[model samples]
Target: ARPRVGYFYTGKTGSEIITEKLMKYKVETFQSMPIVVKEDDSAYDAISAMFLSDVGTLFAVDQDNNLVGVVSRKDLLRASIGNQGLQDIPVHIIMTRMPNVAVCYPDELLVEAANRLIDKQIDSLPVIERSNETGAKVVGRITKTTITKAFVELARNELM
Candidate 1:
């Protein structure tokens, strides 16, 4: 017995193209209600509060609402284990700062950008763009789950 590879005249599955084509499917931050916090806020309180609000991650923004950093559950857990007083510590002290953060544009093909997740071994990518006449800022986040679900849908559509 041997294996078979399904082949069609269409190229590259265009998962990238298909993903990009589905840009209309992109959901806005206001629609999803992203978790955001000021850098000066208490890391523990903000994280705990957002968690209670059903948010899995939090974005740290500056007074300009520019994305300055990000904090994940693991980061918060590590900080908490290291210092109980982190509850009062500012989020800036615990957040993953810029130059170290991972980001993706909302228009970027979900399939192409999904590779960054495995390559960087991260759970999500902050969706951002240059603020009008200013620095970059996070507008939202795209999680692994988002891309995975999108791909599954694409696959299903092909079958149909």
Candidate 2:
């Protein structure tokens, strides 16, 4: 026997919902190849290019495409201003290690993922999933913008 309960079941994937209704479900999906740098890459050149790429941080890679670390814009800039040798140095010297990385899976709920972002106080999270027998592979990126835009659209529809 099914339990009786009143539930406001919302239909999935309808353009008729308007912007507001869509906002709440506007979660990040798997997309966008992550910008990456190798562990042994020249820090100066890599950092410069990454900054110009307009990403908050650069994903550091090993010989394989596996994500190993993250180097933030501030860290790179500080290193650059402090040591001329930083240009020749490898990103490993300034990267946050894999153990410290705050990552989420592509299937994670937007509300739960957003909470994790708030708790970690990070601008974005690299969406990853374990591949075969290898390390985690990044599939997408989730930024605060993801959720905000969703909510904004929903609000717009509700108001209209």
Segments of candidate 1 deviating more than 4 angstroms = 1-33, 130-132, 158-160
lDDT of 1 by residue, 1-160 (tens): 3335674444546576755556545434212345788889886687776768676678888999888888888878788787458767788888899979888775665554677878988877778864465766676777777766776766788311
Number of clashing residue pairs, candidate 1: 0
Error of 1 at 128 (Å): 0.7
Candidate 1 displacement at residue 65 in angstroms: 0.5
Best by TM-score: 1
lDDT of 2 by residue, 74-128 (tens): 7787788874597677888888889798987766666667787799987677778
Clashing pairs in 1: none
TM-score quality measure for candidate 2: 0.72
